[model samples]
Target: MEIQNKSAGRLIKLIISGFCIGLIATIGACKKDNIKKEYPQGSNEQINTWILDSLSRYYYWAAELPKKPGLGQSPVAFFSSVKNASDRFSQLYLPNQAGVSSSRSLYGFDYAVIQEPLSLEVLGLVKCVLKGSPAERYGLKRGSYIRKINGKIFSSSNVVALDQELLTGRTIKLTLTELKDGGYIDQPELNMIAGLTFEQPVLHQVIERGGLKIGYVYIDGFSAGMASTLVSVFSGFKSAGVSELVIDLRYNSGGEVSEAAGLCAMVAPGLTYNTDFIIYKGNKNGGQRKESIGEAATFDKRLDFNALLQNNLSLSRVFILATGATASAAEVVINNLKPFMKVTVIGEKTVGKDEASFLISDQRIPKQVDWEMYPIIYKLFNAQGQGGYAGGISPDLELSEFTLLPLVPFGNANDALLSKALDQISAQKVNAGLRSSINEARSVSQIGRILSDSHLAKATQSIVLTHR
Candidate 1:
């Protein structure tokens, strides 16, 4: 993720700390207009006053709010003042921007760009084309190389502008190209129309190397829809008689908390039904909650676990590929599973956030406030009472993604991250001494910033649960 520089007072601290907290309160309906008629239109200061009241009453750090924040301040400024100084994940966002984080309003084929291997050229790589997305209709496949958009060469300066246009607009033009004979050759341009799409988070495949059949699954996030998909993927692995597993979490920051538990229950071999999986401790005002290990019958969504039983790998150990972006519900998977199985982590250090946040919005005065607040509400601990990993969870073997620029396909044996995991599974040379040369000189693309912004939104709105 590309780091941003901000003023001492206003920091874009992208510290995501949480899992699913089932406190989703509905916001006032969005009208064709942005105006709210329930409350009389007042000066900007009056609006700020309403915001202050909401923060004081419901914010996790209500006690930390200053006694008399100047009401004359803008809502954003007042928000910054009332925020807990120590909390980096607590933040306020505009309602429109917040909508993007929700699965309901979100529609598009999610993709990201990367620097092409052995060159400074940036290429748009399709991360996942949603099942019914326009990208899919237009035949955009994974690993599709997008050389240009709207007749302009994709560069750091124009990527954000193009992204906003593509997401918000009805239609977008693209220019497809390929590198041939060390030169760019144009392919057919496409004009894709945006529509609703349900993303398939579980990507699976099987590999046999060095007399070991490995089941590889790349989970994008732990969305509610993915719970059953995970079961099916694991079932496939079981049917293939795979002896090992590799989970790729490089782009998965987090999603639903229940899904995390479901994944653990599916993979962990000998878990007793209804055992305490993890504990959540909130502030003095916010009581603690415990999540138990059990079948999908206990989940809010009631995910099917029939596949889980049929295809439980029950391996003694599993390999995970992660990066700094691996966090929240993703980290929860790693932390909670440690007691049950051997988890070999290979990649960079984790984001180190072991807390959770709630999606806090205001209806104190009924449509009086037009914003939402995501506040850090609780700290999470595993069954071993281990929490407060604010420095991030360290990897057992540290490797860099920069070693293999423009990442190869998920299960490709040559992919740096996957290769290292396979090596460990096959008991290859302990230290092959392959490291990335990436340093301060690297030029970050604008798409990188766009992705980080989206990721931060997803990471901050986690719901920390307490089970009894």
Candidate 2:
């Protein structure tokens, strides 16, 4: 009986051991599966190498590049230092960053430029701003002439180069020439310290022509919150029964794609649209695979059409004032709005750069690295599939000449372009026998006379300089 009991006990022990082994094997299988599915496809060793390489590259690039102040720090470290920095970076990397940033700077004259001859000739205006000082606090009024920056004569040819130099967080010395007695006479020399915080977008009113109220919204870069601002401005115009809108995207280097799309949504209204496309390549085994023609292991996702369709705010007429400075997101705005409305494109062709970029960091490699890449993951296409604008968007109503005006930075909208659009809108009203809802016919008649004045002809000549 004792022998039989001992045998039973041994049998039970063997069974328990088998069950333990099976449980461990099952757990191991699940762990392997999770790793395969959760991580981007690669061998364990290879992924480790890639990750390290990416992190190292990111660190090195940040250290070497001429980035914005406080941006050269480690991404991981930056996020750690600032609460919600990750969310900020995610939004910043998008194409709409320029517009968004521009919208944010709308409150103050964070930056200023000298209006060009055409700008002054067309609108009889010149503008500059109190850099690093708020417009209200410094008493830097609009329509002020920037005679010189740091004792150097300011001109259209050198404004861009000078602006770049000033962005280096240095004190800029300026001589102001206020517009008084109908001419620009030199005022006093003023010293201003510039910083990244001083850059802001401006919206200004130009001359009212032909009973039509005109406004100018100058965009320097597309960042976040631009779409909302645009919507608000247009909505205000609609409420006020304003007849025309002039969007000056001149000197605008592109930023966020989503912001561009958002702007398109506001302008185009009810159109079903797809602005961009993403192409993905993968193996049958659901692993990352290389493409023969393009970059390896990438996939494409087009714009969320449903989102855009739902937030539609269509405009009747959109006059895009562009130049060589309009690029990327700006180009996207121009491209997407073509189908839905009468987009009267004016100015020079845009910078042909529709491609998007991504920031990457991986640590599972031989070296820790992080980097940015302008990967052509997606192609931008209109309804017709024609995407290359290397030649830029040609204006439907071409100006006889072009001008380089440095208006009171971007905020002082009382300028030539807005005035011209207002004139055109007023002329349309008179020819069609349609009266504007906001203004009396008498006002319209007076504006018509002002628009037809011989001075306007001279202004037109000065604004449009023929460049072969």
Candidate 3:
């Protein structure tokens, strides 16, 4: 009923990552002289030339860029033509175009359309409600199930269509069912507008397990300010005298690499500014480059690694909670920190997005180039040269969050995944794990599947190298 999105000036700071280096550095700046505008300014041919220049220089598969390509097609079509057949994350955005889309439209919550194990009725289950978004303000609690959308019931056949409509919609009306005193109860119809500015969904707390105090934090997504946010949380964990830590990234699809690296440094033991973080592999023009923690730290102003280290748990081992939704920058934390510590991943396998991108556009004043490109520019490898999880990283202990229905919120002992992680920490040993990487997608007929988690969702959610 209340309008929250109308006043959102900086929209979706939560969804998209990396702000200080806000994609202002032009990928084509150095080679602008080499690129001559064959057509008039803002013309299709000229715009295509800019796109070509960017891809040719920075695209991971730059060698595949067409030399004698047609320039007459629209920019979007043109981008598709030249991109490598293997590239999945590349995207081109029109000016002011990315801002208004459903992706940026702050629905303020994320949900999974799951099938009731017995009744087999498809229902929309709220996975997480952004800390201060419209959904949370609407009294929509995590673990609540949606029975109807605008009075229409959910079925496998209609769930997918309804989700699409829900995303594109401005005002979303939903009838949700939640776990009450002991059973599910119908709540009143709730209406939310997808217009709030982005707010990162980061929640933290300290839990006592036996004699050890454990610091548990749920990181939903990574962005520019994410590191500084962690700095504060870790500072508290230090104050709490917590001995063990659990990072709940079950719903994080990832954002900026800088933010990801910041998290790595925050928890890993004996890490310094110069610690090797990532090795980037690209085509001819984009030669291989390695970045250290110090180098990656510079991209974000809020990431005070020194402060984070002061608050660091200094654990020799860690437990990371993941799922199919965990990927890109999120995967970076799991992969890159392995050498420095024993990283045990729990929950379902990750959505192996083994690549990172450069946010490309014309950074000139009164910009001549009107489109923005988020092309997969680098194959991200950790310090040990461990890359290529195209299928996803298998969990040391594989467990599905949807294994049980009417899920409780994160950090709740009733949560299957989080509970298992706590059990592992108590026993101080990981259970025999499964290494299978097959898709965890439920049966198509059983539940309407939405391409919600990682494994690609347009662009904008990946490990982006936004600045020089």
| Highest lDDT model number | 3
Residue 206 local lDDT, model 2: 42
Candidate 3 deviant stretches above 4 angstroms = 1-37, 98-104, 178-185, 299-301, 364-366, 428-463, 466-468
Q: Candidate 2, residues 1-468: lDDT per residue as tens digits?
A: 999999999999999999999999999999987663343344333343333333333322222322222333443333333222211112112232343222013323433342433224112122323344433344555444456756776565665555444433345565666444445567677666433444444463443556665545666556655554565555555556555567777555666665565556645645544333222221222222212111110112233344444444456777877655467667766776665677777765655654344444333465333332222223344444556554556666554112222232343332334434544666643222322231211211112111111212111111100000
Put down candidate 1 lDDT per residue, 134-226, tens digits, no spaces. 677787765466777677777766667666655565667877666555555778888766566766656689988778899998887776656
Task: For each candidate in the order shown, give its overall lDDT on alpha carbons.
Answer: 0.66, 0.44, 0.74
> Candidate 2: which stretches are off by over 4 Å?
1-143, 148-169, 178-184, 196-217, 241-243, 272-313, 363-367, 375-377, 398-414, 428-468
Write down the TM-score of every candidate: 0.72, 0.51, 0.82
Q: Give the number of the best model, judged by TM-score.
A: 3
RMSD per model, one decimal: 16.7, 15.8, 18.1
Residue 399 in candidate 3 has what lDDT? Answer: 79
Tell me how candidate 3 scores on lDDT: 0.74
300: Cα error in model 2, Å? 16
Over all chains combined, what TM-score does candidate 3 have?
0.82
Q: What is the lDDT of candidate 2?
A: 0.44
Ranking by TM-score: 3, 1, 2
